[model samples]
Target: MNEPRSTYPFIARGASAELFDMGGGQALKLFRDSVSDEMIAREADASAHAAACGVPTAAATGQRIWDGRRGIIYPRLEGATLMDWISRNPMRAGWALDRMGEIHAVMHRVDGGTLRSLKQVLATDIAYGPAPDALQRAAIAYLETLPGGDALTHGDFHLGNVMMTPHGMMVIDWSKAAAGHPAADAVRSEMLMRFGIGPSDWVTNLWRDWAARRLRRSHAAASGVSTRDIDAWRPVVALAWLRARDATGRTPAFMRYLDGALKQAGLPFTG
Candidate 1:
């Protein structure tokens, strides 16, 4: 395949992809060369699945290869992200969160079909993470004990991934979409809201805690999923996040949360 050489200025960039302006209100999500073809196909399939299931999301135009890079084209919706909306209307943060919960619930109702398993993903991350062998074994064992579900999980669902267009809200970024229990998905979302902020201080930590709690409560209420269900996945999600950070050699205060979660789950952690 010929390398994609375009003068179209990049409008945005993420961890693994760059959004290039495609004329006529469209954008190309060009991924890094490191991304595998399977990963690209998985994302494209998930995006289409979400749309077919009645979830609000941008439709993938088609998969393309340029310069050995892969990407999907999608319409460029005009609106602010949920985060930007909340920033512009701080007093309506609760409303924004509630909307987020509603969208998540809708997503979880969809059947996962041929999507990848969330449990398997967790197991893989645990195996590769810096956790001690004992902890890794215990985690994988605990994961086996959990019940399975066919719900379509937006593995990386968060306020930022939601966009508020004039037509309605549109979800983006299906890279982590998976087939699994909704509770696990909810837990992951809550964890990201709680600890994904960079370089946290006391005040920031307090604020994050407050926001995370509200977000969790809002999601639980809207989705009719119990707090217990979501909490059950907390340890697993925390370990995954810790492992990701470890992979990058960054030790953040959130490691304490992972330790606490493991203890709460009755897992022995020497590290």
Candidate 2:
């Protein structure tokens, strides 16, 4: 099919050589400023797969070339972001979180019908990929030894990745989709919540404490996982946190958080 003739409104762009626009009556992700073609293609592939699973998303409507970069376009999404709306309606706080949890649960169930795995994602080379072999080996040994579960992981799940609209909540960004233990995803969400926007000091503290307790409870409730197993997985999530920071350069905040994770991993902390 020929690409849409209407120029989409420029909504966003990423370092990976893409400029996204919303003028085609839907959001369009065009890869122009891509750091690498592989990253854009990986995300596009994952987006297609995720859509196949009945996940809410802008359909892969068309493709176009811009500034010598290939671009894939999806229909524009409709609705106010849940995060944005929540600021106006504080009463929906609990409901928003509950809704968030439900979508995530369904997403985890979409793990099947694909060969995606955390190992494969980790193996992908970034500008400063994954971690040293010691980190990967240690993490793999731990994940391997643990009692496993079948679940889909959004790879990168956080408020920033979720959008709320009249239809419902939808997920964006699938560059890191994989099949993995939900607990690991849970742990990562908790880590990124710190990097989130908004939340006054008191409110942030309240949510952090609430989230921590929730995680402890979830870990306790998960079957067949001993304290030692969870402890071992600790490094996996922490290392994954470091991997994210490394993939993107260490922002001031990221560096600070890595210190906490490294301190937990018993590695010499770097900032």
Candidate with maximal TM-score: 1
Lowest lDDT sum, 10 consecutive residues, model 1, at: 245-254
Query: Model 1 — TM-score against the truth?
Result: 0.91
Residue 167 displacement in candidate 2 (angstroms): 0.4
Q: How many Å off is the CA of 154 in candidate 1?
A: 1.4
**The candidate that achieves the highest lDDT relative to the unseen native structure:** 1
How many times do residue backbones clash in model 1?
A: 1
Residues 1-271 of candidate 1: C-alpha lDDT, one tens digit per residue = 2226877767877777888888899888889877877888888899999998899999787987755677898888788888778779889877777778878888988999999999898889988988888889999999889878889998877777889899888898888899999889988887777666443667766766676678777778777889778667878877876566431212455666677777878988544
Query: Per-residue lDDT for 47-105 in model 2, tens only?
Result: 77777887775546556575555777776776666656766877776667666766666
Q: Report RMSD (Å) for each prediction in the order shown.
A: 2.7, 5.5
Model 2: residues >4 Å from true position, as ranges? Answer: 1-7, 13-24, 32-34, 120-137, 147-150, 195-232, 246-271
